[model samples]
Target chain A: MPTVTLSLGKDSYDVHVMNGALDRLGDLVHRSRLTGHAAIVTDTTVVRHYGERARLALEEAGYTTSLHVVDAGEQSKSLATVETLASELVKAGVDRSGFIVALGGGVVGDLAGFTASIHYRGIPFVQVPTTIMAQVDSSVGGKTAVNIPAGKNLVGSFHQPRLVVVDPLTLTTLPARVIREGMAEMVKHAAIRDAAMLYDIRALAEETELGFTLSTIERLPDLIARNIAIKARVVEEDEKETKDVRAFLNFGHTLGHGIEAAVPYGELLHGEVVSLGMRAALFLSEKYAGLSAHASEDVLSTLKALELPLVLPEGIDPATALEKTLTDKKFQAGMIRFVLLGALGQPTISDDITIDDLKEALALLQRPA
Target chain B: MPTVTLSLGKDSYDVHVMNGALDRLGDLVHRSRLTGHAAIVTDTTVVRHYGERARLALEEAGYTTSLHVVDAGEQSKSLATVETLASELVKAGVDRSGFIVALGGGVVGDLAGFTASIHYRGIPFVQVPTTIMAQVDSSVGGKTAVNIPAGKNLVGSFHQPRLVVVDPLTLTTLPARVIREGMAEMVKHAAIRDAAMLYDIRALAEETELGFTLSTIERLPDLIARNIAIKARVVEEDEKETKDVRAFLNFGHTLGHGIEAAVPYGELLHGEVVSLGMRAALFLSEKYAGLSAHASEDVLSTLKALELPLVLPEGIDPATALEKTLTDKKFQAGMIRFVLLGALGQPTISDDITIDDLKEALALLQRPA
Candidate 1:
């Protein structure tokens, strides 16, 4: 197991990147002695694909396993769903001593982890993430939340999982678009913190073996591991986002979340918005952070070659999308803190980013109707 | 200002026991500098009594204050209420940078604490306890939760407050019944951890000074502080109750929660059931822990003199009440773990109590109605 140890004192845990890692979840859980009763929470689509495998792994490890399924989109990441899942867990005899396994993508992970966080004033939970977005991004962080009607992740808690089992093999079944969209996060990781990693990822994107399909990429496990390591380092430095360092991880999320919220929640994938957000950030970087024209060109070319959309999809109004950013959790006192690229790898936080700057940046992402 | 420090490392905080602590809550909250946006979560009844006072204090402290009121009683402690409050907080423009104040007794404290634990994955919160029960017990622990239709506190999280402001002045307006019901917990605390405290409480019970009216208590702040200290010692030893030391604090809660839930939720004040629960535990103590008959009589006399209940209410069934204990959160791997008293001041954990013993003990609490 190539594990990335994310240390947050008592809340620390390992993010294990191993092929077929889901099969070994039983061993990891048993080693930790988390619980004999396991509640596996997954989305409807994921349950059909990985449910039995997950159940078998835990049951063989002497766990009394039960499956709880939610719908397979962002809408399922909600309080009502959490309430229903909790009631089902109670019915399945999952007590305070029982451990919860979030066995899918970010939606399932967020909802299940949030459920476990409050199920009995908190219980042990593990993230068996199946998507690249979740593996390298959401799973390693202790941030768990559900979308309220007012905003995304408006209500939740800082409950860390006991362990994270990242099995890249699970992503093999995902559609190509989902996989490609998830890579946007990896791109953002490189842009914000690691210049060398960005060049490396761009080089890999030029290689023939790096086809968009999961079957074509044997190099993904290593790529994902590097991204997780970068994220793990940042999270270890600031788990609760109190020191503004963790705010670095929210590099593209300000406008990214805004765009995601502006459209129908499930319309454009989360990473797609971030991809558009990154493209817009490059414009902001040039205008505000003294990013070079040559460097911005290189970044745009890399994103284009990787097939990530560089602008908002048709029908999205730039102004409406800009309005959505106002409610961003990043808004403090009254100003929205924007994280812009100072250079290729240097991300800078600016509280002085006016709404006019946001509009100007979003204009670059507006596709003609 | 008299302060009792309840230290649990990162979770530790001071319990300020002052005669007019509520008036200075702004100073304490501001001193900690937890957050500037204050969302005060109180009940309708509470807001009417101290709502203006609370609002003025925080407002004067320069906090942007928003008041969210829930109807009084146990029913208000639900996920629906949490959802509504969260939405209200959002509407009030509370961001993660805000702090929350829980300004009521057990119901408001539990609901508000729970709201804080999950709202924006938790923000800083302060507890301004108004009732004797909350001051002596619930407000000290970080256990925040809501009632699911399945059970009381079946869903929650462990989010400790930055400060617990206990103003004895708030108790002056509490109904006499609420005050007596509260004494049950103080009696239970004395019985389990401190014999001298128990004797002192017994002496207090015999005095004319211990009247059913709230205005009669001239020496309550010290008595309340002593009980909080006993609880503080137990909670410090085990913040999450993993080591079972804190479970000792639940000496009478096994059957107590059952009685509360089996009847109408609002019908039995929590401490009233716990009072009867303490009476039943004494019977079990005699049969299983070799507790002296004289000691049991002394405990009973103390409870009776304090106006706490010794038997189940007129309508609750003995069998139904016993069944509710089966779902106790203290149950691990299907066995209900009971905290019983070995003597007046010796509380110990017991896993060997059979159903026969529980039935026999509970039978003692049956009224002849």
Candidate 2:
């Protein structure tokens, strides 16, 4: 097992990555001293797959486990879902000393984490991420939130999890498309802070089974450990994302969140939108951030080879998309700031772009004739 | 002007108290470096009285001010109120950099503070508390929340305002009953942490005008300053009430919140509920935590003299009222912990009581035959 600690003073917690670590959950929970009733928040898909195993593990560990299965999609990431989960927690008698274990993908992680954040003014929670997307990204950061009607993640809190148990073996049952979607975020982390990891991921993408094989799962522990370490380092220094160090983590998210907002959630997974947004951001970077043409080409090639979306979805108007960007929470002082790539392993925030420039970038993302 | 600083690391802000300082709001905003479009969230009662003055303050401060008025009452401290305020904020194009000024009593402070906390993943806000209850307690604690159907302050965050401007002159137009409501919270603060202040308040409550004369207002800055200091000390140590240091601030809030949750809000102001709750807690403290009989009598005499409620409302079943205390957010391990008075200046939390014990305490609070 590879262990990485996120230093947030008294709110600090550890992220442990290991294949088949789910069996050791009982020990981890024991060591953390979180006792009493445990509420496991997962989704329909996850409950259908490994929910029983997780329940058995917690039961064997001497916890009274209750399951709260939410609808399994991006739509589940809403205040309504958070309310439902909080109500369930209250009904289940989960209190300050009780534990909330989020056992699903990013949607479940975000929703459950947020529910824990506000329930009874906040409670302790553990993140048992069952998807690659969650293990690599959402579970490591304490940025928990629920989407509001006005914007995605517009309602939430920075409530850190007590522990993150990343069991790579859980990803075995994930659909191929889901695996591809998860890789886009990993690719984003690499593009922003780790060039060597990007090179390795690009090489791994060409293999048969698209890097979801058992051997690939073994490599995942290390990859996730490294990605989580990078995120931990950034978040530790700036937990609330106020500083530049934390802002680098939003490499592809400025436009990515806008894209996700423009489209109906569940139609496109967050990583899929992020994949295309990364390409648009790269183009903007090349034009306005003084990035070399080769770097932009490298980004496009990696995204394409991974089978992720590199262009805007059909029927999305450039003007409409540009307008959405302006309204994004990332906008400040009437300027839409973009996290641009200066080079591999480097990211910069820029707001000096004209609407015409963004329009041209969006136009370029249209599907080829 | 008496200025007190709330040192919350990077989130530190100033609490400015002065007579006629509402006119100096322009310079204060400039000092805080908050610019751009601003939204003033106040109730109709306040708008009808001090709206133009607050507007001129922001306008002279170089901010384009937009007003959002809600109904004036504790009933407005609901999620529906928050949603309405949020919609108004969105409609007014209050973006990330925009400032939200909560101007009114505790109701406006809670509603507006919560709206700012959730709007766009949190925005900077200034609390211009126009009521005594607000300046001394709600405005300083960083505990902003909206009541839910399930509980009071069931949904909210610890989003601290960038500045708290308390103009004692604002109290000049406040109704006598409203002034008394504010005094309850002030007395609660003193009873929890400062014996000297409690003694002083006891003396002040006996005077004509309930100590609201110009000399009293001149003495106001220091009294409000001391009450706020007590709260600020507790909050500074534990911003999230996870420890005993922070729970001390909840001295009268356990049963107080239950009463507020049971009654239709606005029927009994927060201070009224807190007053009754404080009496109940004192009886419990005398029985369980070694509170002296003479001290208890002094507490009753002071509250009765202030005309604050010292007994439970008529027809309220003690058992039913006790049930609400069980669901209080402060419960841990199925035990409802409460902050009880050890003496006039000392407060302590105890979980070593039964529902029957609370019922017994409640019986003591029954109306005298």
Candidate 3:
């Protein structure tokens, strides 16, 4: 697959989506002019699979490498984990000139990227995303964060990565559920920015087992790059998420995050909750934004084809989800700025999303239509 | 007495230096176009003195306000304080559009600024620095951090404040020792960028008791602004401190921070150690940078006039101080980027200064002369 460049002027970087890019991680970092120590932050599970391969690749490229692993779960995304990682980085002699290699899924990317953002008031980092969620979405933008008891991603920074290497080959090792989680975001990208990509996604889902079959891995790079490109374009327009255009990316996140918070984290994967959120949003978009039912169904059909969840998991009260939205970062100055679609590929940010509208949409999720 | 505008394009803001700016805090924030809740993060000591004045002023301007106070001291400048303060801001219903008011000395400013930077992934903050050390130095730069056990300012960000309010009247309530601590940075500014300001500083010390006498309060606004402008200009030139020019501000800080770490914090004030460090820097300047003896003495005489310490406190081993420099942030990538003076106003950042040179500078601190 071709490399997609995120045009952030001086902070601009390239996102390389290819079959074997991970093997060239050191070459990529060297090309970006990143020198000094390279601390690879990953997870125990990911380390067992590809850690030694990544270390050898960096060492072969004439870079000193150190592997720092954490427990493989959302529980590791905390201040304590970040503190421990930072101390380990310092112990490894990582300094202002040193850079971090976030070599795992979204959890590793967010944890390590955030660690790099605050260590010595921030240093450059490279993202070697090993999961579909990271390769397509989290890795492209610089929204690094960790969860606190108060909330998820409550503590974070907009520290962009210096380079991103996405190797689709890693997908073969992921669980089927993880692949579906990333597919949910891919469907979101197609729904909001690239309408035609929905057809491609439908075709890809039919051809491969969640886009991870060895025969399908050959096609995974282009599919992942297209999704990443959509994320990059959105980030380039609003690097800090200050502009409302960035809200389009959060079409499902407002309710998705709320419902995700309603459960013990990890009970439902992030993509599963987002899938449910997208379904609710489609219902609201048709009613509140005059979105054509045809466009809405097109998105829902693609989500269904990918086997993404459309119904909320059992035991999650709609009222609890609604209540959680109140404390969400989306609530700006006591106003809910909801993103809706007037048409496929055309998003509108509306403040007209009343609590009644949300309740009605969430109720629609229970019917499983 | 005038406002100093830090020109950083869109991030530019005004630093108001006036006799009673605290009373007009509401008008200033209102003028800046910041709306929503104002969470004033302060210390226990400061809240007792002027917290009500600040709260009432914002309230009178039709803004909702909350007071969040922590214990007063360097100990409060920790990640724990930042976390507790963050939780308080969240409980106060502070959201994305909400702002933070850092209302105290360096500890308060650093802790609050860092808290604001990470809350909701970054929020605007106003620096209401009440100490000369804060008003003339820390408050002007966007350098915010919370110390970890590994090191000081080990975890932080470059999140600049949207506005800064420096009321010289607040200085009158400060102890003479606190007032002298700020003089160390002021002397640093004059020694680096404005040689003539040294004379003004000496004259100011002569007029009132260390520039905090009620009669001398009127003279403080301009003095503080001048020092802040120097800091502001340097920051504009190197917003991230990546450029060599910003290193000039570290003229005495390298050795100063080393010696400060040599003692249990608060035993010798930051400025007292800096005063000693400045003397040692002068000795190095004469030896390594062709600085004239007369030029060095002229600045030394001004520090003496302010009654800032010229001798290292007994019991602080020079070897320990030198050892501490190895871990100081100034030791960039294994080289000491030492700042020295060729003349009173001519400063240079040099990597040529060896560990032996640091030993010599530390030795100079052992002598009272």
Candidate 4:
């Protein structure tokens, strides 16, 4: 598959998606014009799978490497983890010229990318996302962060990575639920910017149902690249999330992040909550953005085909979710800038999203259609 | 006094150096176009002195204000303080639209500016520097940081402030030693960029001896503004410290910071060490950069006029200091990249400095010329 280049002038970088790209990670990163030492920040679980391969590839390419593995869970995404990783990198003699390789899912990517952002007042880093969610969303943009007690990603910088290498082969090792998490972001991309990509996503969903090996699917790499292209375009338009164009990427995240926080930490994964959030947003889109009911159904059905949840979970409270949106980072200055679609593939940020409208949206998510 | 506008295109900001600016800090910041709430992050000492005045000014300017005070001194420049400040801001309803007023010296500026940099992925911050060290140096460049156990300023970002309000009146409360700490940087700026500024510094030193009130001197504001202008010009050339142009500002810091770590904290003030370091750098400048001995003597005489030490301390180990330089952030890729001077005001970066030369410089500092 061809590489997707995210154009941000001086901060521009490429996202490479291929079947066997993981083994060629060093060469791709080298092509990005980074040299010298490489700090490979991965989690224990991922280190067991591909750590040696990654280190060996970099070492072979004349780049010295050190592997620093954290615990394999969301628990490791904290300021403490960042401090520990920074100490380890310093101990390993990593300097300003060195680059970090975030070689895991979103947790490792966020942790390592953020570490790179502050280490020596910012250094270069490459993203080698091993999960679908990270491959399609987190690794493509410059948003690197760790969860704080206040909220997720509250302490971070917009530090763009030097490169991104996505290997579809890594998805074969993931469970169905994890794969579905990444599909949620893909569906978001289709809903926000590319209605035509929904057709490709639906076809991929069918291939999953047919039990085809994920890496063997002919269009898997291309589909990931397409999602990255959408992300790249949005980021290019507004790299700092200052403009509404980038805020449109929060199509499902505004309510989704709120619902995620309202519940217990591990009760629901990020993408699952986003799936539910998307349903509520679809309802709002029809009412507010003049989105057609048929267009909303097409997106909902596509999400359904990917085995994502459309209804709110039983233990979650609608009132708590609505209140939590007020604390969401997207909740700017008491205004819930809700992202509504004019149609499938057309997103618009709504400044008039009242608390009552949010209540109505959350209330609609209580039961199936 | 007129404002010194440090122009870096979109990141340009004015450095106001009037004696009474602190009383009008809110108006200055408001002129910078920051609105909503203002979180004034100060220290216990500064708050006791001017916190109420600052708060009242901002409130009078139509900004709801909150005061968050940390323990005074450098011990508070830690990651723990950052985490605490972040939670406090979140609790105080300080959001993206709100700005932070760093209302003390370098410590408060760094802590609050760093907090602002990461708060909501960064927000506008105004610098209300109460000490000469901050007003002339730290506040102008937007180099915000907190010290780590590994190194001072090891983790930080180059988040520029929207405005810097430098009230020279604050220097009235500082002891002579505290005043001299800032003078070291003044001397450094003069040595690196403005040789004529040395004459003004010598005159200021005479005024300090002749019992003139610190804030009553007519040229005080212009002196501060001149230092800021030099710093602003260097930062404009290399905002991220990516070029050697910015490194020239570190003319005395290479050995100065290392020597600082070699000794116990608080034993020798920052400028004292830099004064000693400047003497050593002068030796090297004469040896390698062909800086005339007359020019070197001119700088040494200024340090003498300011009562800055030109000799190493009794207890500090030169070897340990040299070893600490290896860990300095400027020690990139095993090269020293020491900033040198070809003349009084012409600085250059030399990558050819060897360890033996550094040893000789340390040795030179062991005795007074």
- lDDT tens per residue, model 4, B35-96: 88999999999998899999998988889999999999998887788888888888888878
lDDT rank order: 3, 4, 1, 2
Best candidate, DockQ-wise? 1
Q: Can you tell me the CAPRI class of model 1?
A: medium
Task: List the lowest-lDDT window of 10 residues for candidate 4 chain B.
Answer: B209-218
Candidate 1 lDDT over residue span A1-369, tens digit each: 678888788888888888888888888888876866899999989999899999999888888899998988888988788888888888888887788999999999999999998897778899999998998899888889998877888998888899999888898788767877787788888887777677766766666235445433566678788999989888888888878778888877888888887897567888888888887877888888999988877767767766777778788888788888887777876877888888877888887688888888888777521
* lDDT tens digits, residue span B68-98, model 3: 9999998898877776777788888887879
The digit string of per-residue lDDT tens for model 3 on A11-54 reads 89999888988888888888989898899999999999889889
- Colliding pairs, model 4: none
Record all residue pairs in model 2 with backbone atoms less than 3 Å apart, i.e. clashing. Answer: none
Cα lDDT, all candidates: 0.83, 0.81, 0.88, 0.88
**How well does candidate 1 reproduce the true complex, by DockQ?**
0.71
Q: What would the per-residue lDDT of candidate 4 be over residues A128-163, giving only the tens digit for each residue? A: 999989999999889988777777788888999999
What DockQ does model 4 achieve?
0.70
Residue B115's C-alpha lDDT in candidate 2? 79
Which parts of model 1 are misplaced by more than 4 Å? A199-215, A367-369, B199-215, B367-369
Candidate 1 overall Cα lDDT vs. reference? 0.83
**Which ranges of candidate 2 are over 4 A from the true structure?**
A208-211, A367-369, B196-216, B259-267, B288-290, B367-369
